[model samples]
Structure formats: C-alpha cells, structure tokens
Target: MFIAFAGLPSSGKSSTARALGRIMEAETLLEPEESDWPLLVQERAVMGAFTALTWFRTVRVPKLFRAEDKRTQGGSVIVDSYYDVLIGDYLGKPAFNWLMPTNDPYFDAASAMVREDWNRLPKADVLVFLYLDEDTWMDFMKKRDRDFDRSAQLESHFEMQELMLQASRRAATEHHTKLLVIEQRSGSPEDTALRVRDRLEEFA
Candidate 1:
C-alpha cells in the first residue's frame, strides 16, 4: 500500500511516518527534497519567485514511475507529503502556499498544474491526516526552528487544518476510503504509534 501521510509542514507527518515504518519494519519512500523546501521557499521569497517548475518531475511522472520502487521494497511503502490532502485543491497547495503569488497569472498557472497532478495520483489506498491543536502545532513548528515561518503562516495553517479536516470528512463520504485523523498530542511516539497502527491495518 502507498500509505501517504499529509499535513502542514512540521506537523509531525514525517516523524510519524518514520516511526511507523521503523515499528512495522516497512519500506518507505520520501519526498527527498522536503528538508530543502522550506529553505528553498525562503530563498525564492526574497527573490519574489517560487522556482518550482521542477515539481513537474515527480519520481512517478508519466503515471508509470515504478511499482517496484515501492512494491518490492518491503511490507508497505510509507510516504510523507503535503499532497494527498483530502481536498479539491490538495494538488495546488505547494503552489498556493509555496508557488503562486495570488495573482490572476499565478492562479491560472496553478489551475493547470493542479489538473495535471490530479491525473497522476492513483486511487490511493490510504491517507492519514496528522492533526494537532493550535498550541501543539505551534510548539512543534517552533521546535523545528525554520526561521522564515511566521505567525501569519501559523494562522493560515490554523485555517487549513480546519479546512483539511472538513476535506477529510468529505473524502470519507465521497470515496469511502480510510481517512484517519490521528491526534498527535497526549503521549509519546510509542503511545501514538499504536493508535495509528490500528487505524492503518483497518485500511491496509
């Protein structure tokens, strides 16, 4: 199963994915440039551009990248991304938040880009949305130490978190796929992992 974990940056998606993989001894594939996206966005911001024409190069481009890279790797391939979000615009997020500058020109470009990626995603097996309350979200974001992130972004994240939760509700009804909102506060990694593990198996 291509288990994709989705949420805002620093919301513990990667942390949870890695932990789950370690516990299950599963294979995993990651968006290799994730660590650099924040810095890249900051670098582009100062120059007034996103420089994301490169996203056109998804590892699974052409919709036939490789089942083997995932399939033969192990128990299941877990991934972390801001994509796979349960929204009409999930595909446009990296662009909206990281690319387009909220102009007609940018909006038009983003629309085109969204349609393309929407075509690429398979009927995904499972989507896990990691949610934390406002205080917990801020705590985790601060701990990561990304200098460009600001309070305004956190406010915007607050909005997206609500929107994504709503989106998850819609997806559950529309697609009837598993849309688990595993809360990430309240305990240790091991504690949280067990709850997530139970949900994953129901879908897997």
Candidate 2:
C-alpha cells in the first residue's frame, strides 16, 4: 500500500507518517527540506511562490514514482505529503492569495506547469487529511516556532486549514482514491496512526 498524508504545516504529518511506518514496517519518505523557503518567498513574493511551488513539484514527482515502485514490489510505502494539496489548493486559490495573486503572470505559469505534469505523477492508494480545528492549528504553529509562521496573519492559516480539507476531498474523488480525514487535535499522532491502520484494513 502507498499512503500519503496531507494537511497544514504543523498538522503532524511527518510525525504520524513516522509512527505509521513503524507500525507497518513501511518505508517512510519525508518531504524535501525547505530550509530557506520562507526567505525565498519573502524576497520575491509572487515569483518566489512560483519558484517554490515549481521546486516542490519537481522534487516530488520522482518520490511518488518511487513509492509506486516499492508498492509494486509488495513493500508498503508512506509519504509525508501529497502533491494534490499543492496543485489543487494552492494554485490561484484564495488561501494563498497573500503569496500568489490569481492574475499574476507567475500564477499562470505555475498553473500551466502543473497541468503539464499532473498526469505524470502517481496517486496514493490512501490520502489522509490531518484535520485540526482553528485553535489547535494555531497552537501547533506557535509551538513549532518557525519565525515566518509566527508572524503571519492567523486568518490566512485558518483559511488554508479549511481549504485543505475541501481540496483533499476533491482530489480523492477525482482520483477514485480512498479519502480519510483523521482529526489530529484530540489525540497523539500514534493514536491517529492506529486509526489509519485500521481504516486501511477496512478498505482492503
């Protein structure tokens, strides 16, 4: 099985993926590091968003294909994030209007890029959304202590949290993949992983 987790920045995706990987003894793949990504976006704004999005998409395609290969070999693989959230939710979406305006030339370029590459990427067998309420999401963001996240307006994050859920549903439906929304606020990621494991069994 190839499982992919999608959610907001501090939504415990890496944690939960690690836990689930341990439980299933699967190979867990973390998203590429974006150490200076915030700085890049801050420096160039719109163009920066375009660059970062393009970079993410470029790096993510091979990872998805690798996950598919492992699955074909009968090994389970888990990924910390899915590309659909980036492609569908962030492209010309209100949630990221602060970063990429809908009318910007870069926005059009980014959209065109996604359209060109969308069909090449492999879809996950299960798409999990780590759902958190506004207060919990904000709390996690603060606890993570990233300066960029700390200073950003809370409304943008809130909108993103909501839009991610909506986008996850749409992507799952479009791909005919299993969609699982697991609430992350009420329990530990390990607990959530167990729930996901059980749900995957049900799907099987």
Candidate 3:
C-alpha cells in the first residue's frame, strides 16, 4: 500500500517510515531534504531544514518520473514529510512560523497543488501520524540543539505541532486518505516500529 509519514518536526516519522519501507520491502519515497528542492531551504537555515527542502523538490518532478520510479520498487512505498504548512515558512518567523495558519493565498495554493497531485496519483495511501507531546518534543529538539532554537522558541514549536496535527487530520478526513496517529513515548526505535507495525497490520 502507499504510505505517508506525517507528524510535527522531530517526531521520528521519517526514521520510522524509512525502517518500515526496509522491513516491508517497499520502495521509500523520501521527503524533500538534503537532495534537492525546486527552491533551497534558505541556505542559511539549519542543515536539517535545508536537507528536507532539498528532498521535497525531488518528489515534485513530473508524474511520469514518479510513476516510473515506483514501478522499479515494491512494498508499502512509504513517503516521509512533516506535513507542515507551506505558508507557515514564508510568513512565519524562523522559530515560530509553524504556529500561523498561513493566510497567504499563494502558499495555500501550493498546498492545494501538492494535495491534488498526491490524491490524483494511482497509489495514494494512508497518512501515518507520528505524534509526540509538547514537552517530549521540546526535549527532542533541545537534544538536536540547532543554533536557531533555544528555550524561547519552545512554546512556538509546541504550537506549531498542534496546528500540524489538525492539518493532518483534515487531510485524512477530507481527502479520503487513511489516518494513523501514533503518539509515542521516548524509547527505542524497534519498540516504536513494532508498535506501528502492529497498527499497520490491524488495519490490514
């Protein structure tokens, strides 16, 4: 089945999605980062964000390329993304843009374009939500210790996480995509993977 890893930043969706792909023998459609994006992730930002932007652009190539690539692959075909708002970045402060609903029309339009493109695809699949509570998320972010962030940015990141959850729910409910919200505690990756794998099988 087609699968998507959705969550706030640092929720471990990408890591889990990648592992799932490997275990299930499916092709992994990695998120935009480190590889290429139609635009850069503001070259000055932290490397992680820039990497993600780079990866996202590669996914946007013409459908023919996407379809062709998938043909050579198998398994669940998991796609990784923060599912964060497109407008949030342009209109938001670097540390807090995610909290905004992104009223910018063009950003909203770009989001529409992405959703439409994915929904129209023949292999569209479930939206897997990897959720973590705010405090834990703060701890996770702190561990990464990006210079752009500090204690002051914690509240905003938490707020952004809430908005992302809402957006993901909307995507699943309104767009006919499946939703799997995995609220996990800090722990081993295998433990988390097994928990999710069970969930996947339950739906199967």
Candidate 4:
C-alpha cells in the first residue's frame, strides 16, 4: 500500500505523514531536501529549467515506490509530499507557466516533455489531503513563525492555498485513486492519525 499526504503549508502534512507511517509501520518518504537536487538545479529560476527539474524529481518517485514495494512485499509506504506537491506548487502556478506558454520555445517544449512523463507516474493507493478553514490555516501559519510566514503577502498565500486544494482534488479524481480529506483544525496530530488509520481500515 502506498499513501501520499498532500496539503497546503502548515496544514499538518508532515506531522500527519509521520504519525501515519508510525501507525502503519511503513517506510516514510518525507519531502525531498534541497540537498537532494543538484545545486545548479536549485538555483535556476528559468521556468523551463525549473519545470524540467520538477519532472526529474517526479520520475524518481516510482523507483522509490518499487523499491519499497519489494522491501515490504505488501506493506504500506507513506509519502509526505509526492507528485501533488509538484502539481500544486509548480504546475499550478501561472508565474511558473509549466502548463503552456506563448512565444517561448523552451518553455513549450519542456512543458510537453514533462507532461508526458508526469502522466506516467503511478498514483498512490490512497491520497490524503489535509486542509483547514482559512482562519485556522492562518493561525497555524502564524504559529510557525517562519520568515516567509511573517513577510510574505497573506492574500496571495491564501489564494494559492485554495488553488492547491482544488488542484489536489482534481488530481485524485483524475487518477481514479482513493481520496481522503481530513480537516486539521480540531485535533492533535495523533488524533488525526488515528482517524486516518481508521479510514484506511475501510479500504482493507
């Protein structure tokens, strides 16, 4: 079994993924670190180059899936932020222009190339989306106290978060995978994980 957790920033994805991994005794793949990619790739702001890197990282997902499949032989694997992150953060961004662009040959070519491979990536058996109402999400963000959390424009952030949630839902439906939406405003991480585990039991 493979479970991928998707959500906006500060929406409890990392904590939920960790807790569920513990509950299932599954191997967990958290979000990839900056060190996981080449430094040049990390520095690139060129839309085409960034888009290509996103696809490159996405391609590695299935390999990890297969490796864990063999290791567990049928056990669960919990992914903190899988392809949905790419979709929400990169592909969904108009600024990134990953889908289509006018007059930029490289961007168009890269978009097509990545889209082809993106469609080939395997869907998770269960995609769990963690979200909160705007007020709750804002409160969580304020508590984190990150630099960006303090400095970035909240209006834009809220718009993007809502877009990402919608995109996640579409992706789950398009892939024909199981979708679980957990509201992260009312419980502790363990409580949410227990609820998720109970939901997973239904699929068993």
Candidate 5:
C-alpha cells in the first residue's frame, strides 16, 4: 500500500506522515532533498529551461518513485509532500512566476512537463490532505523562523494551495483512490496524527 500526505507549507504534513508510518509500520519517504533539480530550478529562477527541467524530472523523480515501489512490494509505504511540491510550488506558483516572467514557449512547455509528470506517477492508495484556514495558516507561517516576505505573496500562495487540493481530489477520484481531507485547525501535532491514523484504520 502507498499512502501520500499533501498540504501547504507547515500544514503538519511531514509530522502526520511520520506518525502514520509508525502506526502502520510502514516505510516512509519524506520530501526529496533540497539539492534536487526542483529546488535548483526554483532557486535559479531561470526561464526557457523547460526542456532541462523535464530532463531533470525524467532522471530524478522516477528514482524516488521506484524506491517507493520497491518498498511497497515488501510492505506499506508512506510519502510526505510527494507531488505537492511539484504541482504547488515548482509549477503552480513561485518558480513559474518568480523565474519565468516572460511566460513564453518555455514556460508553457514547463507547465506541460509538470502535468505529464503528475500523470505519470502512480496514484497513492490513500491521499491525506491537510489544510488550515487562512488565519491559522498565516499564524503557523509567522511562528516559523523563516523570513516573512510572504506578506505580498499570501494571496497567490493560498490560491496555489487550493489548486493543489483540487488536483489531489481529482487524482484520487480518477484513480479510484481513497481520499481523506483533514481540516487542521486547533490541535497538537499528536492529536492530528491520531485522527489520521484512526481514519486510515477504517479503510485498513
């Protein structure tokens, strides 16, 4: 079985995925390394590099997926943030907007590359979506040690989050996968994890 956790930044995705892995005694895959192509592309903010990005995706994301597949053959596997980063951050928002300002042929090509990759991946058996209201999400962001340049970008960020959520729902439905939406408002990480584990147990 493959379980995936998707959500916006600081939405408790990593913690919940870890907890679920423990509860299910499943191997867990966290977000890919920061040095990978996705982060590199975003950091560089280069335009007209869609083909390069596609090559990177072809070379890298599959390796991670294959590892997950190998683990699943033996036992259950849980993944944190998997394609969410690709769809939400890399393609949906910052990378495209911040980097590819021209919105030229390369940008269009890159978007298609991202879409192709999203379709290529095997759908999770269970997809858990973690979301918080705007105020709560902003609060959570502020509490983090990261810089707060998001004041201007919040609206777009929220839009991207919603888009990702919709895509997740569509993917789940199309693939006949089980979908679990968790509205995380007031609760400790442990409490949220408990709820996720309990919900998943019903399907188990």
Candidate 6:
C-alpha cells in the first residue's frame, strides 16, 4: 500500500510517517528539505510564498514518482506529505494574488502549471489526515517554533488550515481513495503509528 500522511504544519504528520515506516518496514519519503531550496529562505513574503509554491511543485512530483516506483515493486511506501496540501496552500486566502498585487497574469500562469503537475502525479492508495483541533494545532505550531510560521498572521494560518482540509477531502473524493482521519493529539508518533496500523487493517 502506498500511504500519504498529511496534516497542518507542525501537526506531526512527518513524525508519524517516520514511526509508521518503522513498524510497517515501509520505505518512507519525507517532505523535501527547505534548506535545499534557496528561494525558500525568503520565508513567507511574496517571493517566499511564490518560491515555496513553485519549488514544491518542482520537487514533490519526483518524490511521488519514487514512492510509486517502490510500490510497483510490491513494497509498501509512505510519504510524509502530498500535492493536495500544496494546492490547498496555494488556494488559501492571502494567497498568490493577495501576496503579489496586480500580478494576476503571473499567478494565473503559475496556477496553470501547478494544476498540470497535480493532475499527472500518482495518487496515494490511502491519505491519512492527522486532524488536530484548532487549539492543539496552534499549540503545536508554537511548540515547534518555526520563525516563518510563527510570524504569519493567525487569521491566515486559520484560512490555510481550512483550505488544506478542503483540498484533502476533494482529492479523496475525486480519486475514490480511502481517507482516514486520525484525531488523537496526545500520543507519541509511535502510538499514533500503532493506531494508524490498526485503523488501516480495519479498512482492509
């Protein structure tokens, strides 16, 4: 099974992916490192957001392809995030247009490119959403202390969270893929992994 773990920033999807990979002995592909993308160092400014949107589009497809390759070889694969979340982020309020004033033409062109990329990527067999309540989500973000995330307006963060969820649900429905939402908030990733494994079996 190819599984894509997804959630809001700092919601523990990556940690859970790592834990689940260990238990299932599956090959895991993490989100590409931001440090490797020079453009991302700009943070959440117009350049930063645009760079992030474009850069992830550039890299994540290849990562998804690699996961698909491993799955085709009869191995279970896990990915920490997927393109759906990227789309959500792009569509959020104060998105491209709001970030870059009077640049609808560029935004439109970029949107076209991202949509093209999204349409061609391999779909995950299961999309596991690590659902966190609003309070917990904000708490986790604070705990992580990512400067860029911390500095963002709270309202924008809330908007992005909703947009991401909408996108995830849309993807699941469009592809007829299994969508499992895990709402546990206090457990270690190991515990979360065990819960996820059990839940998947229930689906099976």
Highest lDDT against the true fold, candidate: 2
Clashes of each: 0, 0, 11, 0, 0, 0
* lDDT of the candidates, in the order given: 0.59, 0.76, 0.57, 0.65, 0.65, 0.72
Q: What local lDDT does model 3 show for residue 198?
A: 81
> Clashing pairs in model 4?
none
Error of 3 at 172 (Å): 1.6
For 1-204, candidate 2 gives per-residue lDDT tens digits of 899998888888988999999999999998754464555545545446677566666666777889999999988999998854346545677777765678776777777776655455688889988888878887777766665564445436577777777777877777777889888874687898998898888887
Give the runs in model 2 whose Cα sits over 4 Å from its true position. Answer: 33-47, 84-86, 151-155
lDDT of 1 by residue, 7-81 (tens): 766787766777777887766556544365544444655434424433423432322234234654544666665
RMSD of each: 4.1, 2.5, 5.6, 4.3, 4.3, 2.9
Q: Write candidate 3's Cα lDDT for 41-145 as tens digits.
A: 434243334353324544543332453356557434666653432222222434344322345334455556455544544434576777888777877776656
User: Candidate 4 lDDT (Cα, whole model)?
Assistant: 0.65
Clashing pairs in 6: none
Per-residue error at 61 for model 4, in Å? 3.0
What ranges in model 5 sit over 4 Å off? Answer: 32-42, 46-64, 71-74, 84-105, 147-156
Per-residue lDDT tens digits of candidate 6, residues 25-88? 9998887543565645445474545665666666666778888898899889999987543463
Question: TM-scores, in order shown?
Answer: 0.74, 0.86, 0.66, 0.72, 0.75, 0.84
Per-residue lDDT of candidate 4, residues 5-32 (tens digit): 8776678777888888888887777764
Q: Looking at model 4, which ten-residue stretch has the lowest summed lDDT?
A: 147-156
Q: Clashes in model 2: which pairs?
A: none
RMSD of 4: 4.3
Q: lDDT tens digits, residues 1-204, model 5?
A: 777887776677777778777776778777533344454444343423554455455564654576457556776877776562246234635423533444556776666666766666666778889978988887776665332225225434665567667777777766677889988876677788788888888996
Predicted structure with the largest TM-score when compared to the true one: 2
Instruction: Find the 10 residues in a row with the least total lDDT in model 5.
Output: 145-154
Give the C-alpha miss distance for residue 66 in model 3, angstroms: 3.6
